[model samples]
Target: MKPIVVTGGTGSLGRRVVRELLDAGREVVVLSRRARPVADGSRFVSVDLRTGDGLDQALTGVDTVVHCASTLTGGDEQAARTLIDAAKRAGVTHLVYISIVGIDRIPLPYYRTKLAVERQLEASGLGYTILRATQFHELVQHIFSLLGRSPIVPVPTMRFQPVDTRDVAGRLAELALGEPAGRVPDFGGPEVRDAKSLARAYLTATGRRRLLVPVRVPGRIMAGFRRGENLVGDRFDGEWTFEQFLAEHATRRPSRFTDAGGSGG
Candidate 1:
């Protein structure tokens, strides 16, 4: 098999995908804004997706391209255009793009960008597969950090079926090696969970006694989450549950208030 090129190879999901490909005995080339240190046999190339700098070199002799690079919170269409144009120039055979579930139904800027990119891929006349995945376990951690120090964990009233990044990576690698099938079934975690409950569990794991506050966000974006727009289709399957993931990496730490001696600083 010709080498597989992974855009954003230095990112969280991109790195996992590259590792999976390499483990399967396929040569992996990582494309990023800067060259990074590689494992003994892995390869890395510096390429800026924004300006299309060094993209042609990154795609040369690469038969499969796994587009894992993305701008957080949105900016999908521009990224897709840069990659597709370079892939066409390089004569790449397969293009596999990773997208979020419910992008079409959600009104978030990020989701809107993703939906636009999907449309572009469909009309690009390239052999392409778009794999939509639910939120990752790390998303909870991100939420906690974003909320900062509060007496309670305030979460939007939303349902989620988060999946493990590792599982998503494996599936993407398989798709990159196989034929393109357009939009595939969405992948989600093994069980459904509410934001408040998940937040409570996270607090408990950290030995905190904060209340889990469910907030109803206003507007179409919030409505989308309330309707569980980020869930997978019935045909898709995943192996990890939120509890299972927590058990594997749970750590006990004092609450922020306790750390600051109950001062509301």
Candidate 2:
């Protein structure tokens, strides 16, 4: 197998994908904005997609490129374009993209950018596979941690199917090892969970007593989430569940408040 370059290889999903590929005895190169310490025989190349810096060298002699870098704040489209152009010039064989589920239905800013990126890849004349996955367990936990900090946690009345990052990484590595299949089926979590329910579960697991206040956020984005656009009901392909993820990591983030305090701060 030729060398595989993973963009954003320092990120949560990208790192896992790189690890999986390396574990399978594949030559792996990680593309990041800054120099990072890499062991286990993996190569690290400094590249900035935002500025198109170091991309040509990063993609050099690379057969496949797994694009896992995304900016929730902005510039996702530009980055995609930069990568597509660079990969084409490098004679890359396969280009794999990581996208979010419900990007077509949701009206969120980040989702819109992702949809744009997908279009660019399709029209770029590159052999590509776009794997749209639901939210990661760690991302969901981060949101809950911020909201659960207050006594009366304000949770959007939205449903989420948070899949494990490790599972998503495995799927990505598998895709990279095969032929490009264009846009594949959506990958989701084992079960569907609402914000309030998940928040309560998190509170209980972390020993926090916070009153979850369900907030009905109006607008197309929230409406889409409420309508289960973020959930792939029948496509629950992920093996890991939210509860299992919590069991493994929840202990590390124990609440500062104990049972003696009714509403945690």
Candidate 3:
């Protein structure tokens, strides 16, 4: 099998996917925007998806490319289009894209970009597999940690199904190694919890005290989350829960948390 190239291999999900592929004894190449160290047996190549620089060289001998590179900021569509073009020219046999669940139903900026990327992959002539998953536990933790700083945490009255990044990475690795399937079943967490409940759980796990203010956020995106548009009803495929994830990573809590909202990914 030709080596698999993982875009954004330094990111939370991409890094985990790279590790999984290497563990399976498959030749893996880590593609990133900047130079970074990778797993002992894996290769690393600096590739900027924004400009397509180094992308062609990175994909030269790569038969499969797992696209985990995404940004909460803009330019995701351009990046996806550029990647599809480069992958086609590089003779890639299969392209696996990791996407977010409910991007079609949600109207958030990030979701819009992800949805557009999905369409681009669908229209691309190259063989592709698109796997959409719920938000990761780490993302939720970041959001909560941000809000936890204040005396009263204002949590939007929304719902979430936070899956583990490791689980998503495993699925991506499997898809990278398998035949391309257009779009598979959406992956979700074991249980769906409201934002307030998740916030309380996080505070309790991290040994913090804060009044959680559940406010009705007025927006189509929040409305979509309230309507369970971000949830997968029949596909509760992940094993890790929010509580377990908190317990496992509680020791790495930052002394100061940022005051930013959670990302839509």
lDDT of 3 at 255: 31
- TM-score per candidate: 0.90, 0.93, 0.93
Lowest lDDT 10-residue stretch of candidate 3: 256-265
Identify the runs in model 1 with alpha carbons over 4 angstroms from their true place. 73-75, 233-236, 248-251, 255-265
**Cα miss at 68, model 2 (Å)?**
0.3
- Candidate 2 stretches greater than 4 Å from native: 251-265
Report, for every candidate in turn, its global Cα lDDT versus the true structure.
Answer: 0.80, 0.87, 0.87
TM-score of 3: 0.93
What's every prediction's RMSD, in angstroms? 4.2, 3.1, 4.5
- C-alpha lDDT (0 to 100) for residue 143 of candidate 3: 94
Tens-digit lDDT track for model 1 on 17-133? 989989899999998876776544568988878789889988899888999888775555777898999999999988999999998998888888888888999999889999999
Collision count for each candidate, in order: 0, 0, 0
Task: Pick out the ten consecutive residues of candidate 2 with the lowest summed lDDT.
Answer: 256-265
Which pairs clash in the backbone of model 2? none
- Give model 2's TM-score versus the native structure: 0.93
Model 1 vs. true fold: TM: 0.90
Clashes of 3: 0
lDDT of 1: 0.80
